[model samples]
Target: MSRWRTALVTGASSGIGREIARQAAARGVDVVAVARREDELRTLAREVRDTWGRTVEVLPADLLTAGGLAAVEARLADPDRPVDLLVNNAGFGSLGWFHELPIDREDRQIRLNVLAVTRLASAALAAMVPRGRGGVLNVSSVSGFQPMPTNAVYGASKAFVTSLSQALHEEVRGAGVHVTALCPGFTRTEFQAVAGSDVRSLPPWVWMTSAAVARAGLDAVTRNRAVCVPGAGYRAVATVVDLAPRDVVRRLTALATRASLPAPEAGR
Candidate 1:
């Protein structure tokens, strides 16, 4: 049985977020599914309700907007409803040279990945700390383990998430509130398509399914683990990244990223 009575999961329209909602419901937790797409959220709500007989509330909101963020924050702070879990899973990435990429998109990425995650976490913790029984699972990425040359902004944002989660975990553990960072490696999801990350060259062994990632994250938070790196391969990679010297890791990451990209045209 799940420790949580109710969970609010963002980015619930698809991928890991969607799987987390389904799996949490299966584990007997009621869910509030949030996403920009109402149709998708409603569809997930129906599926979860039909499959597990759990209450699934569909909340449609874009976290980037002030009105959307306010709506979700208000829901998190609602004492009557009282969300027992907060899953900060709504994020996206852009793969390219930082200088060449659109500045507005990068700013938006920070707002969604960093600003929104921080705001929602604050709202949830404000309520949960007083109650002394709740959890927060922030969905981060393995790329945060090191400096990603091509995907700089995304990496930095996830690094912030991991750091913030660990700090929050230490702060609220005594209060019986769990805070965990779910750092997943490459997973088969719409994330790659949305981010324009071509992972066709990456081996199948490096990838994990969304369901497995979701299961590991939910289990980690339930057990009050501070950090959960889903796959063995990713865990190993994260360890190496952690141990390596900063400069060496940065140089190697740049080289690896360059090697993965197509060569520039012979003539500019």
Candidate 2:
């Protein structure tokens, strides 16, 4: 991995983030795990140390908050313990109607998913580009490829990540910095529960493991692929969507989103 031995993974307490951190450690990369759960982060650190004998720093901070975001940004720009790779993976979604969801929840989603990714990526690149080697893998989603009516905020946030990552990939290529966006479809993660969606209700084949997605992302980073949609099904879907007409895509997406969304409770 060379100088890409150290990586900082956000949302590292569970699901895709946890698996990504584990995979990085398995590859001999030291990891810094960031999340709001102090206990979870500490446990992950211990697991990494015992299982892979790798260094793991536990950063217990909610990236949606200004203090937490600024603290992480400062760490990224730190000269003494420079981070070689950045995985901007912390994010959440609400499955209810956009109008029905709390304003603060929606706002926090944008803060963590979009704002934090932008700031951290910029911080990492500022350090990496000058010295000429590092990588940033933003964990986007397949929802980013098209408009999703029910998952509007979540999909839009991921679109921002995908677009930002691709542009940054080109911008930093000359400086030997790798930037990639991993746009995975439904993966087995806490994201489903938190988002108020049930993947078990969907087809089994539609879901991939967190490990698989994270592994594909790291591979893309190492190979310098700007975008990667893991799993064959997702790849094919993305390809078809890429070639499909805009109006058709929008109609199909709206129908699918409406169908997939769970119905609201009775007296609410």
Q: After superposition, how far is residue 243 of candidate 2 from its true place, in Å?
A: 0.3
lDDT of 1 by residue, 1-268 (tens): 7899999999999999999999999999999999999999999988988999999998899999999999999999999999999999999999987777899999999999999999999999999999989999999999888889889999999999999999999999689899999999989999999999888889889889999999999999999999999999889888998899999999999999878766543442
What lDDT score belongs to each candidate, Candidate 1 first? Answer: 0.94, 0.90
In model 1, where is the ten-residue run with the lowest total lDDT? Answer: 259-268
* Tens-digit lDDT string for candidate 2 (1-268): 4347899999999999999999999999999889999899899889999999999998888897889999899889998998989999999887767777788888988988899999999999999998788999999999899987888899899999999999999998778899999999988889988988866678789889998998998999989999999999899999999999989999998877778766655544
- lDDT (Cα) of model 2: 0.90
Model 2: runs farther than 4 Å from truth?
1-3, 262-268
Q: Give the Å shift of residue 80 in candidate 1.
A: 0.5
Cα RMSD (Å) per model? 1.6, 2.1
